[model samples]
Target chain A: MFAPVILSIKVAAIATIFAFILGVFFAHLLTSRNIPGTSIWETILILPMVLPPSIVGYLLLKVFGKRGPIGAFLLDTFGIQVVFTWIACVIAACVVALPLMYQGAKAAFQSVDETYCLAARTLGSSEWKIFWTVKFPLARPGIISGIVLTFARAIGEFGATLMLAGNIEGKTQTIPTAIYYAVATGKEDEADVLVLIMTLFSFFMIFILNTWLKKKNYKVS
Target chain B: MGMYFKIKKKLAQFQTDVEYSFDKGVLVIQGESGAGKTTVLNCISGLKTPDEGEIRIDDMVLFNEKTNIPVKNRRIGYLFQDYALFPNMTVEKNILYGIKNKPEYRDRAKRKELLDYAGYMMETFRISHLKKRYPANISGGEKQRVALARAIVTRPRLLLLDEPFSALDARTKETVYEEFFSFKASLGIPTILITHDPRESELFADDRIVMKDGKIM
Candidate 1:
C-alpha cells in the first residue's frame, strides 16, 4: 500500500519539476514575438494532451524501445536501456503532464502588460533581468497553477505508465497501475482505497491552488 | 545636445511621416486622438522602430537604415502614460531599479554611492515616507512621482513623457506640474512630451509641433 503511494508521489514530483521548467521556457520562447508558424509548433507541443493515453503510451514505447533511435543510442554509447525502468515512468509522466504546464504558463506570460516590459527596458534593464524581475513574478500564479495540474496529471498517469513501466510488485507498480491490477483481479477493497487516496491528493492540490490564488488576489486588490 | 529624427512608419489608419529636432527644455508634440502622437515617443525611445529613416541625438545615432540601438542601450528614459510601475516592487526599489539592480553596480561601495542619489530623488519627489509602500497602495500623484523618480534615477541624456499627467485628476495634475518644472530645471535634460491637451501644451511647451493624421502640421 505504502510502496505504491510513495512511488507515485516520487514520480509525480520529479516529473512536475521537469515539466514546469521546460514548459515555462517553451512558453516564453513561443509567445515573446512573432515566430513563423508558431501556431503549428504549439499544436504539435500540445498533441499529447489531446491524444488518447494508449496512443501516447504506444508512441513512447516506439521511441524508447530497445532498438529505437534514442534507446539504441543510449545502449550503444553508455550500455544503458530506458524501457521498463524507473526512468521510463518519469519520462512518460513528464511527456503527458508537460502540455498542462505549457498552456498555463503561456497564458500567464501573454497576459503580462507590454507597458511594464517597455518601462523596464527604458530603465536600463537587461532582457534577462526583465524576465526574472518582471515577467516571472507577474506570471507566477499561473505557473503555480500549471505545477499543480502537472503534478495531478503525472500522479494519475495510467496507460502510459502501464505500457512503459510494467506492473511489478514494489519496484515499478505505481498507485494507478496497482489499482488497475487490483480491480482486474477482484480486489475491490484495495482498489477502493487507492481510488480514495488518488481523489484526495488531487483535491488537496486544487485546494492549495485556490487558496493561494485567492490570497494573492486579495493582496493585489 | 539637441535631437533630430526623420521617420516614416505606415500605420493602419495613416502613414506617419514626420521630421523634427529639439535642443533642450520641453518640446510638446500635440495631436488629436489617432494622430500617432504616442507612436512618435515610442520611436524616439527605440521601443518601436521606425519603418525607414534615421534618428540621431547630437553626434550619437540611435536608429537609421544601417543601425538600430537596443531599447535598454538607448538610455532614453520614458515615463509611460500609465506610470507602468513594476507591481511586485516597493517605491524605493522601483526608484533604484534602473541602476542598483543591474550587474555594473554589484560593488558595495558603488551601490552605496548611487543610493545617495536615489535617496535624493525620492526625497525631492516627496516620496520618502511612501518608500516602503507598493504602487497600488500609493495615491495617483504619489505614483506619478515614483515613476518620475524611476525614469530619471539613471541620469539618461534624454527623457520622454507620454501624457504623464493623463491618469491624474485635475487636483493631482496641478500639484505635479509644479514639481515637474523644478525637476526639469535642475536636470536640464532634453525632453519630448506628447499630449492631446492644448492647455498642457501651452503650459509646458518651449517649442511645439502640431500633428494631423500623423503628419507634422
Candidate 2:
C-alpha cells in the first residue's frame, strides 16, 4: 500500500530532476541561438506530450529493450538491464513530462530583453556566465512552475510507466498501477483510497504552484 | 587612425553604404528615426554583420571581407537607446558584470582595482546611492547612469551611444549631459552618438554628420 506511493514519489522526483536539467538546457539553446529549422526541432521535442503515453512507452521499450542496440550494449558490457525496472519508470515519466518544462522555460527566456543579453556580451561576459547570472535568474519564476508541472505529470503517469516498467506487485507498482490492479482484482475499496490520495496530491501540487506563480506575477502559457 | 568603417548592408527598405574615418573626440551622427543611425552603431560594435565591410579601430582591423571579430573581443562600449540594464541584478552588480571577463578579473589586486574604479565611476555619475537597487526599481535617469557606468567600467576603446539621453526629461538630461561631457573629456576615447536633438550637436559634437535615408547627407 505505502510501497506503491513511495515508489511513485521517488520515480517522479528523479524524473523531474532530469527533465528540469534537460528542459532548461534545451530552452536556453533554443532561445539564444538561431538554429536552422528551429520550429521542426521544437515540434520534435514536444511530440511526446501530444502523442499517446502508451506510444511513448513502446518507443522507450524499443530503444531500451534487451535485443535493441542500446539495451544490448548495456546488457553485454555493463551487466545492467533497464527495461521492467524502476529506472524504466523514471525514464518513461521523464519523456512524457519534458515538454511542459521546456515550453515554460522557452517562453520565460523569450520574454527577456535580447538587448540585455547583447549588453552583457558587449560588457565582456562570456555566454556561460551571462546565462547563469542574467538569463537564468530573470527566468526563474517560470522555470520553477515548469518544475512543479513536471513533477505532477511524472507522479501521475500511468500508461507509459506500466508499459515500460510493468505492474509487478512489489517491485514496479506505483500509485496509478496499484489503483488499476486493485480495481481489476475487485478490490474497489483499495482503488478508491488510491484514487483519493492521487487526486489530493495533484490538487495540492497545482494549488501551490499556481499561488507561487501568481506571487511572482509570472504568466505561464 | 582612430576608427574606420567602409560598409554596405541591405535592410528591408533601405540600403546602407557608409564610409567614415574618425581620428578623435565625440562624433555625433544626427538623423531622424529610420535613418539607420542605430544600424551604423550596431555594425561598428560587432552586433550586426554587414555584407561587405572593413572596420579598423586604432590601426587594428576588427572586421573586413575576410575576418569578423566577435563582439566580446571588440572592446566597444555600446549604450542602447533603452538603457538595457539586467533586470535581475543590482546597479552595482550590473556595473561589475563586464569586468569579470577582463584579464585582471582573476587577479586579486586587479579585481580590487576594477571594483574601486567602478565605485568611483558610480560616485561620479551620482548613482552611488542607487547601487543596491535593481533596474526595475530605479528611475529612468538612474537606469541610464547605471548602464553608462557599466559600459565605461570595462574601459572600452570606443564608445557608442544610441540616443542616450532621449529617455530622460529636460532637467535630468541637462544634468546627465553635463556629467557625460566631463567624463568624456577625462576618458578621451572616440565616441559615436546618435541623436535628433540639435542642442546636443551644438554643445558636444566635435565632428557632426547629418544622416538621411541611410547615407551621410
Candidate achieving the largest TM-score: 1
Candidate 2 lDDT over B1-217, as tens digits, reads 7889887889998998889998999999998999988889998998899889899998899899889999999999999988888777778888888887898889999899988998898888889998898787888778887888788889999999999999898999988888778877887888999999888988789999988888999
Q: Counting only residues 3 or more apart in sequence or on different chains, how many pairs clash (N, Cα, C under 3 Å) in candidate 2?
A: 0
lDDT of 2 by residue, A122-171 (tens): 88778898898878887888899899889999999998898889999778
Task: For candidate 1, write residues A4-74 as lDDT tens digits.
Answer: 99999999999999998899999999999788999998998899899988888889888888888888888
True contacts kept of 2: 0.68
> Could you tell me how far off, in angstroms, the CA of residue B111 lies in candidate 1 after the best superposition?
2.0
Off by over 4 Å in 1: A218-221, B101-104
**What TM-score number comes out for model 1?**
0.96
Q: Which ten residues in a row are the worst by lDDT in model 2 chain A? A: A212-221
lDDT of 1 by residue, B1-217 (tens): 5899898989999989999898889899998888998888888899899999789999999999999998888888899989999888888888888986456589888888788888988888899999999888998989988988889888887989999999999998999888887787887888898899999899889999999998999
Candidate 2 residue-wise lDDT at A193: 89
